[model samples]
Target chain A: MENIHLENIDFEYAPGRRIFSGAAVDINQGELVLLCGKTGSGKSTLLRLIQKELDTKAGFVMQNPDNQIVCDRVYSELEFGATNATQGNERHRLELIRQRVAETAGYFGISRQINRDTHTLSGGEKQILNIASAMAANPKVLLMDEPTSMLDPIMADRVIDLVKNINRELGITVIIAEHRSDRIFAYADKILLIEDETVVCKDKRSMAEYMSRSQELRGFLPEIARSVEMSPPPLSLAEAVFGKAHAVYVGKEAPLSSHPVLRLKNVSFAYDRSKGALIDNLNLSVDGGSITALLGENGCGKSTLALLSAGALKPYSGSVKINGRKIKKAGENSAMLFQDVTLHFTGDTVDGKYNGMHPYDLSGGERQLAALDIILSKNPSLLILDEPTKGLDYNEKEKLGKRLEKLRDEGKAILLITHDVEFAAMFSDRMLLMFGGKIVCDRPAREFCESNIFYTTAGARLSKMNSD
Target chain B: MRRFENFNPATLLIYYMTVIIPIMVFMNPFIILTALAAGLVRAGIYERKIPVKRILFSAVLTAVMALVNGLLSHQGDTELFFINDRAVTLEAIRYGAVNGLMLAAAIVWFSAFSRTLTGEKIMALLWHLPKLALLISMIMRLIPRYLERYNKTGLAARINEERGQVPEKKHIMQITSAVFTWALENSMDTADSMIMRGYTSGGKRISGIQFRPGDAAVLALTAALQTMYFLPETWHGILMAVLCFLPEIYRIKENVKWKIYTLKI
Candidate 1:
């Protein structure tokens, strides 16, 4: 039976700017529906229409968790929906609400943070709290509008797992609108493609069949699925439609250099003096004309190390040196690009309003490029980027990779701290793996991909699987 | 560190309002002194230590206010000397001192109030008035969020090369303008998110903390103290002074009891 059904729905942002017209959608029980489209293509609007918090028994999670959390504390945020559902006599219902909050938080592995301030939670934890709050409402269907769009790779994967678990355990139908199809496409049962105010719904089999017929839509396929060729692409290498994996290209690594552009010696840092250092006694150097990728789990001090290396943060002990001289001020010899691109825009540019529009109104990829351009205008000897490929599409990621390569060829030292293993594999000359505020391994990018199994790229994984 | 941080916010509101109203009404020298001393103690407790710098700044401010009042208003009987052909009388100085003390006491009490009454506490206390509670919460979030965005905007202005030849003042002005604009625009998203989460959906917001027995006791005590204002001027003034110092007296009694217990052991 269809849990959610919409017939001939018309949605328009303004009189002339029509988004959806005569769109019809039907979602069945226990189905994992995937909503795929370009940005501003009305995916979120459709989800909102379906959820309609006032009328339907549907839970909607927005893109940015920071804006979604309605309460101050974690426990209160989780209870927000349930409290809104209560009719009368809060004293009697609060006990049940508390129990529900505790149970939901425990299910999402956020029970320890129940008493913590919601605003104080990390980005990943905030997204988890958002999902937990939605589930506490006891909705029949859960609709998430790009829930993982603002999260790092680690957090993004965790959110997907939670969605999968909720569907499997509770038998609740789930619909997710996501741009990162590479991360979410595997678990989907049906695919809904929205474009130009039209919605086309299809099962996985028919969707793959359609992809086989159209090359334009093939770009929407996951990277792992694209590694092999067949009538319908495979979700995993183990279940490939093709006979074997294609040959994966590996980039050549640059030679090591003695003269370094930026150097860190015995650097240590701690947010609180009493809790001990988060990054302890780390020493490293980035040679000019090379791309160095720093890889680590979220909250493993990758960003802190990036900031320290960029001279934005001074170490408690030791020093940061640029061109073998002690750094005087931040941004004098370095420029750091943070994960959030919106925080880096100047709101206006010299050239006729920066692409003829405001920075905030631009697309995610455009905003990122604008931010990069702004940073590059400083023309620092060293470029330190923290998760630069966070919200970029495949084409945008390629453009950024080319830009970084050009910078490297210009003898500019680049420190790329990212969760994008594939992008790093394509561009980086060297790779450094950090665990618990310390570098555990440093190797050439090629060797690094060939050595590791889990953290390796999808192309490398497919190659290994085929070779076996 | 605030002694009343986690107490029922309604109780804190009643307690502070009840204490401050009488101090404003009586305006007597003795009553003002008691209120000032109590205000300082409350601020100290909330800060978890003696805020020496703040106290010194308040003293300087009090002196300035007293000096201004003494020079501006010459309504005293006993004239001491003349300053620029104006009578600088002893009675005028004393009256200015009383006014200054009242202003300083109010400032200190408010400082403590701001420290203790966080956004969460205000929301809990004003659940019945949802719009007002939401406005207070939004303002509380706005200040920190604005500061953070302002700092980031400054960094962005530099990266954009907008600050290359501009002076520091111009750079600061540009960054401030950008931050204010962004904050205004971002508020729309915040409002939408709140609405999507079922805010203002004609339902009662169930606060986590309910009114407990101790909260009721606090409310009763504040109510009884408020009634003392109707008593005779001298008698009521003395009661007001004692009420102001009640927290300090309790703390002293508790500390002495603890010290004696330690000595016996």
Candidate 2:
């Protein structure tokens, strides 16, 4: 396979702010390169270039599952490229393409039933389907932009393993731009440190040295990798402790109020008459003056419960109250961000008149941020968001966490349902471990998850704490 | 496998050229019947049970459609029978039935395409095409993405109690407004993406994705079929039309990937 050579390549979206200029680099074939950078450091843009999605033959698995699926049935998506050969007819040929599609689907572990509806599948299933789809496209190069950022640990590892298989067997070159690199770190052939726009350093280095030597490298460190004696670190509680205790708290007192911000009693919701209720007889309470972090496996109804709390969905049999007031519909007093930001950003009034662009054009993370911007700017009394960390780089999530702390200081009852335990822990005073449509554990954020636990951030282990 | 049963778009077109197209243009019943029989045979190639079911379903659908058209479009010879005040002639019914069957066959045939081949694979075959095809493919990619998004959106809206019948007037206004909003946001995003990629204000140019010879050869064949269809000689015209129409067989293929893609959002 041929590789592109860059000589003094320079670029910037806005003038004067050079994202990458006078940069020369050669990326070899058949390597899984990991990119490290802070938010807006152009990691995604770089990936786009490499994947040929932007200007470059590399295939990309879209960050948002919604963006990846182009067809209705999972089988069709797999065979769509082949079936398309005989556009209007070719009935027999279409059937022939089925077995191969099914095989590829199986590679991703996608069951037969889930292939029918791409939207309804779980996050991991969607990711698998997307990867398989991209791989089948037969691109020589693959560039993944935080492909597993939002997935559960087990599923994320599975996807990584799948990618690894393709890389090894098929010799498909892979490039991954990730903030937290625990999953792919040991496996990465080369580490490219992207900081402050330009690639500061590239090539070989020990993981420990790579972690410590560069100032810009700090952002990619796993959570709880630092101990906080006085206050929590910006990324982790420990980092806050070491920086400045009083400043970390920053004139904000720990949440003392125990009043329930949201209360759901005996709630049940059914998607369709045939499949049975998705959530059944569930009871939950999220208290006020405290950052409440909700966690659960995919399809465990974490978002459903969050909706009830946010007054988006009324429980079938039970009642949901926001600060003792029952919710009748979705409106002010509360704002809920959906798992996929595109679902909520369909702005009718804002199209064509301004920039000839729809909210749909933005990437998944951008849409999420945009939705958050709209809700936060609106000054809702209770802020409810779903998978807010999705599509965001590590630094963006941290910035959002810091923003949440500021919002908390402003007395906004923040209720978040997320797959990100570190994100919730970084900001919340309280945490709830939810799975299988129920809360498995609930406790103070300070007393909550250890780094090694499920849903915890990668660098959150006590042993990994940075010693200054 | 029977050649007729192998109705992938290319084969379907070849069969259409040899059969259906001629019948349509020449107004010949023999050609149509001959092609239809061939379809039945080819339909049985892969799995015996599958083709029979496909043919049966196609025939039923076609027959139903033909019956409806015959009943409504009663301007033909009254060779068969009469129902009510309307003259439901055997000739008209036959004509309508044949047309309906064709429609049904085409629909099922195309669904078979989606079943067998995928979009990415087709794209690989068409890799050498101009940027327009790539853009078309990209937009095609968006169809399923949009459908999924819309479905999820509708569900979210329903759960949020923002969904209601409201009145036709309000509904139209809301839908129009939503569509308009969606369009604007999407365009802006495309622009942003373009700008991000250093797309200067001009026609598109390909920086990468050179076509392999295999894909180029496929494109040439496709182009040839398209040209043959456009040629106006009665027999050749018939042939080309049939070939060109083969890809339209799978109605679901034109739609999203989801087996059941409803406007849930």
Q: Which candidate leads the pack in TM-score?
A: 1
True contacts kept of 1: 0.28
* Docking level for model 1: acceptable
For candidate 2, write residues A1-468 as lDDT tens digits.
Answer: 846455564667878978875556666778777777665667777776654542324566645454455555665455543333222333454454455556666666665654365656777877787777665545577777777876766678788888888877777778777655655655677677665556654543454345554444545644433222222123444444455432222111244676676677888876675877777777777665567887777777877677666666667788877777887667536777676565554454223323544565554445566666655544666778777786566657766787787877777777887776667767788777766666767766655554235555433334234333
Query: What DockQ, on C-alphas, does every prediction get?
Result: 0.24, 0.08
Model 2 chain B worst lDDT window (10 residues): B202-211
Local accuracy of candidate 2 as per-residue lDDT tens digits, B116-216: 45554454444345345446555765666556545656554443323353665665455456645664545554443333222344322221223355334
Share of native interface contacts recovered by each model: 0.28, 0.11
Model 2 spans with C-alpha error above 4 angstroms: A1-7, A12-17, A24-26, A48-130, A133-140, A149-154, A168-171, A203-216, A224-255, A272-277, A342-370, A376-380, A450-468, B1-148, B151-265
Return the top candidate by lDDT: 1
- For candidate 2, the docking band is incorrect
Positional deviation of residue A321's Cα in model 1 after best superposition, in angstroms: 5.2
- Model 1 chain B: ten consecutive residues of lowest lDDT: B155-164
